[model samples]
Target: MHGSRSGRHRSDPGVAAAAGDSGLKPKGPSTLQALTDLVRLVGRSNAPQLRLRLVGAVLLTLAGKALGVLAPLVLGAAVNSLASGQGTAAAVGWGFGGFAVGWALVRLLSSTAPQLADVVFAPVRSAAQRRAATETFAHALSLSLDFHQTKRSGSLSRTMERGARSVDFLLRILAFNLVPTGVELVLAAGVLGARYDWRFGAVAVVVVAVYTASTFALSNWRLEHRRTMNTADTEAAGVSVDALLNYETVKSFGAEARSAAVYDRALGDYTRAALKANSSLALLNMIQAGIMNLGLGVMAVMAGFEAAAGRMGPGDVMAAVLIMISLYAPLNILGFAYREVRQSFIDMEEMLKVTRQTPQVADAPGAVALAKDTARRGGSIAFEDVGFRHDARANGLEGVSFNAAPGTTTALVGPSGAGKSTIVKLALRLLDPQGGRVLIDGHDVRDVTQASLRTAVALVPQDVALFNDTIRANIGFARPDADEAAIWAAAEAAELTAFIRDLPEGLDTRVGERGLKLSGGERQRVGIARALLADPCILILDEATSALDSRTEAAIQKTLRKVRAGRTTLVVAHRLSTIADADQILVLKAGRIVERGAHHELVAHVGGEYAALWRKQTRGARART
Candidate 1:
């Protein structure tokens, strides 16, 4: 597609109006903002080579448009000279051949110059797209966990994908095609007016104005249809990815047909919306073509009359008609360019919204890393009157306070909704308490950089989500610089050595998507191995052994006991047996700690929450046996 002579980003207000602004103004952290950043990036790059290419691109664009306009004039002049010449036959032949060659050469340069310009601008475009994608992706990742919890994986991925591609499209269409096409239009009109009758230029000007106006109007109207289609597309993609990711659940529940039906409906919605958009596009194209051809016919008629009256020659008539034809050449993509420009803006706008998001949890200004000596001492954790609430949940932490001395174990166990997970999250600085302070080694976690805090802490969750990669890569992810021997040691410590050695590929075995290829016990072991590889001062196990079978659980628990030395450990376990030996067992009720003591002391208290839970579990186990 193409654009008009006016600056679409500034002069034309429809695009901006459609986006609830004016002319896809390079404002906000949107596509236009990306462009603004791109310009600043190029200027700051200190690479004169890129600047030279940019300048070369501009010169070539103008040179291409100029040659295009001159080519038709040369052809027309040749025809006029041949007809009026009284030269010898050989002279006439030479004159005809010379003009033909000259026209072809001009035409060749016209086409080649634009292509060469694109080649010159390729690096700039690539860099712009790469930076935009990297910036948005990094920003999204940096956002708080709450943001990700509410976002659909498929929809977010699609947005980032489309937005990245949009950067490339916008740069090309805006810089090379639409912007230059508009310039070419003005140049063509000026040439027509200067070399021919004033009426010819007037016709060219009116045609462009009307074309640009109508195209923008129709494209603006078409925007809703595109949006509708995109919504459906995103929904369908989200549904499919969600269902596939949980295919095990779907099959276990016998919901395959239901899932397929849902996807089918989503696609049906998308198809209808796409059809409407495509139909609107066809209508716009027809209108554009009609307007362009009408102007051409009018120019030809005027030229013909002038020729008949002997005011102009045959060559002038040909040149007059060809000028309008050549004008339509780049203007041909008017509708497509305007439509895509708006759509790309929308896509990039969505992605940029992510980049603009303010993380609920951010490091305090002038935050510093944890003291190495303090971290080496196992990073003491103290929760002083910490409070947090979830709007949707009935239970939340309330003045929760505890201190885990360095190199000791503190266990939290309670019924569901007791906030064990919330405490874990707070301790990791994944979330900040709404009130009160969470401190590590007497320094408020908020006062230190998150990176440093995380470096000293590691958590092994109940369900470990792993990347689809080799066992070696997954285990080594926690310590990217860890050598092969370190990885093997960690794996061996997690009791994964035997199982991994049994596999044909050993550490090289692929762990499929989300590590689904590995059994729950195996995945848990890999998670433990990864956490172990970090060699963190503080270790958090949130039901880390819940996925393992009884035998594996016992083995892992033994491994954990051995590895707990010199590191503070926080364990949240449903199976009371696993944490029975913890130095301190805090029994939580609702969101508050109701009982705090050693396991033996808590079990000694008759009818106490911990004692009751211990009896119930032991009784159930005896009954099952």
Candidate 2:
């Protein structure tokens, strides 16, 4: 059986209150607020350089649009010259030269400006994305254990990844596509109004107005479909990841079929959502195409009539057609840009929500680091009337008080759910008591910086989760800067060196995910080795040897006896025989200590809770023998 870490800690009420109010669901920021935040975030990225580039980009955009509008006029002049029977070779050459130059310049500026803007803006965009991802990741790590337990790891990862990409996409669309398109629209309308009859400008403005209205209305309608597709996609990924992470359990229970069914269901939902999203997109495209083509046809016919009536030359008709064609390009992209921008906003807002959560446990203002001198004295732990409740109903520690004097070994023994594991977590300050205080080395744990406090204590949990790396790396995690000699010494003390040496790779042997490649006993030894390497004043063995066989347990117990010589040890154990030599033993029932004494002293009480437990275990052992 694999050793498992006990989830016996109480949830923080502050975290609970926050979760109740915010509900952990993605609550997107309002559209206006999201846009404002995006702008602010972009502005924060190397402001001096970004502002310079932004100015240049804007100027280039205006110049490009100006040339774009002027190109049609030049083409019109060339056509008019040819139609007026001025067909001389020089005249035609000059006319066509001006038209070609104007058109070429328009294309050059339109394409070149955006490329230059991208070059200047790349660093700013990258910086903003990095800041957002880093802050969000750190915040997620800082949140309460309860929050992490309730959230899916895969979903959180996707949120950060997608959110960062969305920032880049949003910036590109706003700067290169949407803003420039608006400028071009205004310039085209102005040109038509100044150089032609009012009807021409009116037609251009009306077409744009209608196109904008239709795009907005349809894009808003597609928002729900896109949101649904995103949700389904995230869910599918989460389900697949969760199923794979528990690969052993799935295989053992012959749950491969069931897991596949669950995954298939998730994917099925995603497929349906994707289909709907694509279908709606197709409809939007068709509608936009119809609107654009109809506007172009109407404009062309009106220009032809104006030319026939002598109010405009044939060159004016060609210019009108070219301008309308140019406007169609931007209008074609408008729907897509709007939809993607909206989705990006939603992604960014989701990431912001994670960053907004308040960490349940934080270093208090003016919190100080643990004194090195004090920690060197072998940390003493005191639980001064500590109390906590998991919830309104669940059993939790109640007025639990104990002391583990420096260099002493104290053991907690109890039935499952008797708050034994909770005491261990509290001692390590993994969870804070709602009432009273926990002190280490005479300083309240809450009053010290967590980093410094944790440095003084180390835990060898029953389930030793190892990263998918070499055994050497896992052991070195406790004291990352420890020399190879120290790490080997610690591994030897944990009785793991001989086994590691027998392996083909020695210390370099890879421990698969969570050390699943190792036997349960081997994994526990790795945990012990890591803790020994840490060399902290206080050592917490939370059923650390529970997975080992009797022979391995005895050997590890001998190693632990030596390791505990100058450290305060707190043990939460189910094996009565293992902890018989403890200096003090606590017998808990419900949420409180019902009996406490040395093993011999407790056994002498006959009918006492500890004595009864010892007798029951002794009888069971004799029967097994």
Candidate 3:
């Protein structure tokens, strides 16, 4: 079946192939018509395989309904035969025998249909779920880094999971629940009209119509409640993730109680919303049960009268009553199925919104590929009148421009909130400069492919994040195709091979979530090893050894000299001694460069901020000793 225009398909047939021969536009339908349109809309795909499965299901359902109607008629015939006294024993015996067989057949089919439906629908449901998840994740990853910075990872993950599950729910409703219910309704109406009179059919139709209307109305009203519950649940999840990630900090401050209180507030809101939703659902169920049985009572009374007046035979009356009760089985699921479908629609809308979001940092059309270049032969990095500001921030960097020649280490030291990281982020194209440009090897960063640009640069972040996997796997992530020898060499250069070799599993040991099993110094070494494996032309150490012990820091400092020998390196650090041997140091304050000189030269300047920072660090180091 084809989806609606709102859910556009890849292929469109000619206008002549549409429902209208004149090819005129089709107007929107009324609510009842719209419901029919929804079924047609869902059926528009017209997949031959799906059609065949649905056809088979419909045939099975009709057979089941026919048997169901037959059982009651047979039982009523036995009663009539006993009343007539024409070989009553023999007549009753045959009638009951036939009824037993027919009843058994109906019961057997009723149980088998769901199993058959699942077998047929599983592939379609899985395919739709896969499509939805793949698209949602791809779209999220494609968005600019700035967009990601503002969103929570846990929340995004939850949205993607919910969206994917929604597709499965929708497919099951459409393929199994809703479709079978529709078929049952049609069959019941036809049998009632033929066996008894149009009045019986009218009563059946009215009850179903009222049941459907009430279901829709109640579901629509509950939508806001569900949405509120979702919001509260998301907030609760986000709070827990945030707290757990910062557990150490919370513990350090002895604020566990405060954190728990915050979480409780979110959970409390969630509980209230959940209660409201469930309560509303219960009320709907209660009302539906009352109305449906009342309608059944009315139909049963009419059927008795018809039999007494001889307008319909006793068997016909019994068949009409039996069909009505049998049809209620599917109708019972109809209410909950409708609710799920509406919920699925809401989820689909959210997923589509995310999927349709255009990436802000998309590559220009006809963009050229970036060519690989090693540090041994790579050239200088430069920025020209670059300016940037976060969408949420009023100011970031303004007209900042600088250059670091190849075979030199440029250290950027700054006060807190000085936009030093912003410069790095912009140069790496993680955040595009609103004005001017950043160039690497004389090529504009935006002019070349991101893959090529990233391949040319490597970053070792201050807070090194490692995967929960083998030590070798984490280190070799930068170069997945690297051999064991290459991995060992990189680890040795980072001064970590000896420690890894001593572990129980050597390099194959599991890291435990975010490398929590490893010490701070060890995690830092792993980060360095990853960067060494990458061997990018431009290397960035953003306080790479900050978490290490002083002894380990001193050791890694020696490793850094060898690593930066031929590479263009940018070091952002607060510890002045770490960058004392750098080719140049840029001191920044309030988003602008305050001073630029060698460390020794900057130290010699009496009134410079770098000189004061140096004295303060020297005093602190002496106190620690």
Q: Clashing residue pairs in candidate 2, if any?
A: none
Per-prediction TM-score: 0.93, 0.91, 0.84
Best candidate (score: TM-score)? 1
Off by over 4 Å in 3: 1-100, 221-231, 261-277, 600-612, 615-625
Instruction: Give the lDDT of residue 45 in candidate 1.
Output: 40
C-alpha lDDT values of all predictions: 0.83, 0.80, 0.74
Superposed by TM-score, candidate 1 places the C-alpha of residue 540 at a distance from the truth, in angstroms, of 0.7
Ranking by lDDT: 1, 2, 3
Q: lDDT of candidate 3? A: 0.74
Which residue runs does candidate 1 get wrong by more than 4 Å?
A: 1-48, 373-376
For residues 474-562, could you state the per-residue lDDT of candidate 1 as single tens digits? 99999999999999999999999999999999999999999999899899999999999999999999999998899988998999998
Please give, for residues 159-191, the per-residue lDDT of candidate 2 as tens digits: 787777778878887877788888888888888
